[model samples]
Target: MREVEVSEITKEIAELCQEANFELGEDVINAFKDGLENDESPTAKAILEQLLENAKIAREDRVPMCQDTGFTVIFVELGQEVKLVGGDLEEAINEGVRQGYKEGYLRKSIVSHPLKRENTGDNTPAVIHTKIVPGDKIKITVAPKGGGSENMSEVRMMKPADGVEGVKDFVIERVKESGPNPCPPIVVGVGIGGTFEKCAYLAKKALLRPIGDESPHEDIAQLEKELLEEVNKLGIGPQGLGGRTTVLDVNVEIYGAHIASLPVAVNINCHAARHKETII
Candidate 1:
């Protein structure tokens, strides 16, 4: 068995936290460029240009692109053969968040309690999702999710008879209602199947997939394409002013669900689309 130190995990998480905040993935940048060529609305094209400039500044300056540095969301694929050593894994992850936020000069937006409204001070107790996989290495991805887009997200528990059409209608309606709140030119993550909470997790996880990467399943890929077309037709535009570039991409992730239920979730991310990952 391979032994991996928790400190190593902490160190990597720290760097990822900062890197995710500062960088916009190439896929996202390319989508913005494509929007400029295809969005039609003059206003949409202008906004897209500004977004490109903002991304450039953030990367070169090594600073966060958005003021709301976001909740420190982490995804870890841990190899079962690798034994964790040196410290508690969760604590290590949290400590890494603390150091990363402080060192990176990122705003700490996490609250200690939902109703109490107390700030965590250092962005500790990150939202961590860990999975055990077959390999001997650990994969860690940090996705900093802003509140605006997150607030616009929703989950609908539908009867199995409702079917795919039901799911499609729900997603479109949610985006239409969201209208400018999640910040236009958004990336929509749709989760089909699974239990209610599991679908929600899947939706958030879906955002981590690179933009434009279609699912392997043909049926699922078709759904993603359809959703993107219908969503852009909404004419919400860039930043919701009005145009055809309302959505940059749609990513759908599915998991097995029970016979009686269909749980669907829609998670939205704004133009920043900040996420970074490392394997160790």
Candidate 2:
């Protein structure tokens, strides 16, 4: 069995937190570039260009792409063969978030309460999702989800008979309703099957996937392609102005559900889909 130090996890989480906020991933940048070239609307193309430029500057200067640095969302893939030493895993992750936000000059966006909201000054207590996998390496992915796109997300329980078409229609409808709100052209993550909450979790988890990658399942892959084409055709181009590309891509993730249920969830990522990952 492999023994790993919790302090290392903390440090890695801290760096991942800052890096995710500060830099746009390569796949995302390429998607924007492709959007700019393919977009027919002059206004939309210009907006995409600005976004590209902003990404370049952020990376060059080591600064966040957006002012709202977002809530630190961490996905941990722990190895069953490894044992954690030094501290509680969750606490270590939070400490990493605290230090990263403070050190990186990233904004603190988490709050203490929903109804009576108050800001958490240091952005501590990250939203951590841990899963045990058969391996010896611990993989961590940190994605800072901003409010703009996240607020526009939706969840629904469609009848099992609705099938693939049902999910496609629901997602496209949600994007249409959310036009210009979630900061198009955006990346749409569709979670199919699973329980209601599990569907939502999978949808959010799909956002952590590197942009431009297609779903592994052939059926889902076709759905993603169809959805991507349809969403871009909405003319809700960059920043909501009319254009040929409203969405950069659609990523669908599926899991098993009950015979009677088909839970669908939509998680949207803005043009600035900031994420970074590390293994330790």
Models 1 onward score TM values of: 0.98, 0.98
Question: Where does the lowest 10-residue lDDT sum fall in candidate 1?
Answer: 117-126
Evaluated at residue 227, the lDDT of candidate 1 is 92
Highest TM-score: give the candidate number. Answer: 1
| TM-score of candidate 1 on Cα atoms, chains taken together | 0.98
lDDT of 1 by residue, 198-252 (tens): 9999999899888889999999999999999999899899999999999888999
RMSD of each: 0.8, 1.0
Model 1 has an lDDT value of 0.93
